[model samples]
Target: MAKKQTKDQALANNRRASFNYLIGETYEAGIQLTGTEIKSVRLGQITIGDAYVTIRNGQAYLNNANISPYKQGNQFNSDPLRRRKLLLHKREIAALDEAVMQGGKTIVPLRVYLVKGFAKILIAIGTGKKNYDKRQTIKERDMQRELGKNLKNYH
Candidate 1:
């Protein structure tokens, strides 16, 4: 018998947010999604390019994360742009709430994936980076790539 690979069902991801922000803290929270929504996520039908995390009334929410409706599911499909609630413990929410109070700091979802059959999101407590900081990051990335290329060629 052949063993099957265990692959996660990724719902969404915000790639560039990390590049533009300095990450301070991270929290993993479960997402409340419907049945068809879960199916769509398993099919990788989602986008988080412009998504953000928001806290209101002591609860965290995923805003602007587009989860495409399941093709075969009708009348049971969830809205693609609907705000989804994130399930986190009270302590985590309070900590995030305090961190968000800092200037220019906010909660941002970095990744959304499935674990143990449940949709989990990795949210970051982050502060925005300045223009000079972005430039420096670009320079550092270029330098690292060049170094790797040179080492490979030399070997």
Candidate 2:
């Protein structure tokens, strides 16, 4: 028997989004990819550093995401930077629309990955953290790290 191969090949992740926002809930959404776009993504040549999600007309879409064109795609290459539509359920889109309508809440793309040979995007409903809130999170993380170190020393 042959080993089954997995289509992981994570294109990109927005690590800073976690620190800057209080993520309330996460949802997985499918992205509409062109032929060249999928090829470029599979090659792990994409970036989501400045990507964000927005709910408009009961649909969620990605903005400011960049997927590098395939090297040999030639005339068939896709736009390196373009707005891509994200597929989500109707109820999910309504919920996202409501959350984003709140004062400081936003929809942000956390990471882009492939699953079962299909591309998937993880979206988070987040609230922008104030400066003090960010500092508190940092302090808590530091404390947790210190506690782990102390526990290891005791053992």
Local distance difference test values of all predictions, in order: 0.85, 0.86
Segments in model 2 whose C-alpha atoms lie over 4 Å from true places? 1-9, 151-155
Give the residue spans of candidate 1 off by over 4 A: 1-11
> For model 1, what is the C-alpha lDDT against the true structure?
0.85
Question: What value does the lDDT take at residue 47 in candidate 2?
Answer: 85
Clashing residue pairs found in predicted model 1: none
Candidate 2 local lDDT, 56-149, one digit each (tens): 7777889998999898899998678888899889989988898887768889888888887678899999888999998998999999999999
Q: Write the per-residue lDDT of candidate 1 for residues 1-155, one digit (tens) a residue.
A: 63222334356768898788998889999889999998887777878887888889999999999999899999999789999999999989989988888668988888778776677888898899999999999999999999999999998
The window of 10 residues in a row where model 2 has the poorest summed lDDT is 1-10
TM-scores of the candidates in the order shown: 0.92, 0.86
Q: Which pairs clash (backbone N, Cα, C closer than 3 Å) in model 2?
A: none
